[model samples]
Target: MRVTRLLPAAAAVLALAGCGAGGGTKAVPPTATGSLESLAAEVKCRPNMQTDADELRQAICANSDGKFILATFATDRGQREWINDAKDYGGYYLVGRKWVAVGDDGVVKALRGTLGGDVEVGTNHSSHSMHGGSAHSG
Candidate 1:
């Protein structure tokens, strides 16, 4: 019957529409990657060199958003270690593959628009004396 056929066609159309609405429009991740200067430029910041070494490059940068510390590591291990130690101070970090932007939450979130990184929040410890307690992992 015409009614039976229309019902199945309508159901098929709805199913296809649901697929597109749910997962077909996944946002593409930001792929911008580069050195301290290039990344800073993308975010419209003038970097003031802080540390220049074989293992890492760091700079202090400021823009209309705010000031932030931008650092790039020579290796993934180096970057992770630096983040682990720095997390004790409690701050917001916009992290990429080999680089990280440390700043207040607002500034860090603003940086993510241009830098395309994950926002990580550091744990703030009032007392540094954890003694032998288990370390917190993100």
Candidate 2:
């Protein structure tokens, strides 16, 4: 009797889980969406504008935690390409919607508390052989 009642509930749970199995369904939360200055404020830092252009906006920021670079991109593809290229040099990156923060692991981790994002580690080229393509310049 109890088993019969629980079967329908279990089936409904499974159906809901299958709905999200298509992948790429992860949504960037509102907390993760902001410009360089806005994001810096969340982490308690004033961004010293470095490169301000149509494609990218980068700034250096420092608070009680430490100093780091904060950048926001105009497009998603551009951001991904930049990250892929920069990885060759080896660094710590905090990735969010159209924005990325580069700093030491401790600094980046502290920033993550206020500005929710994923921490991506760059490849240390020194350990492996260098490929044909060069690192992204400016």
TM-score of each: 0.70, 0.68
Model 1 segments beyond 4 Å from truth? 1-31, 126-138
- Report every candidate's CA lDDT: 0.68, 0.67
lDDT of 1 by residue, 25-113 (tens): 23436956889899999989898886777777877777877777888888898888777766756677788999988877667666776
Score candidate 1 by TM-score against the native. 0.70
Pairs of colliding residues, candidate 2: none
Estimate, for each residue in 1-138, the C-alpha lDDT of model 2 and write its tens digit.
Answer: 111222232223223322221112234344478778788888888988866778878777777767777878899987887777665556677899899887666666677776778889976554444575555646
Q: Which stretches of candidate 2 lie over 4 Å from their true place?
A: 1-31, 126-138
Clashes of 1: 0
* Ten contiguous residues minimizing lDDT sum, candidate 1: 17-26
What's the TM for model 2? 0.68
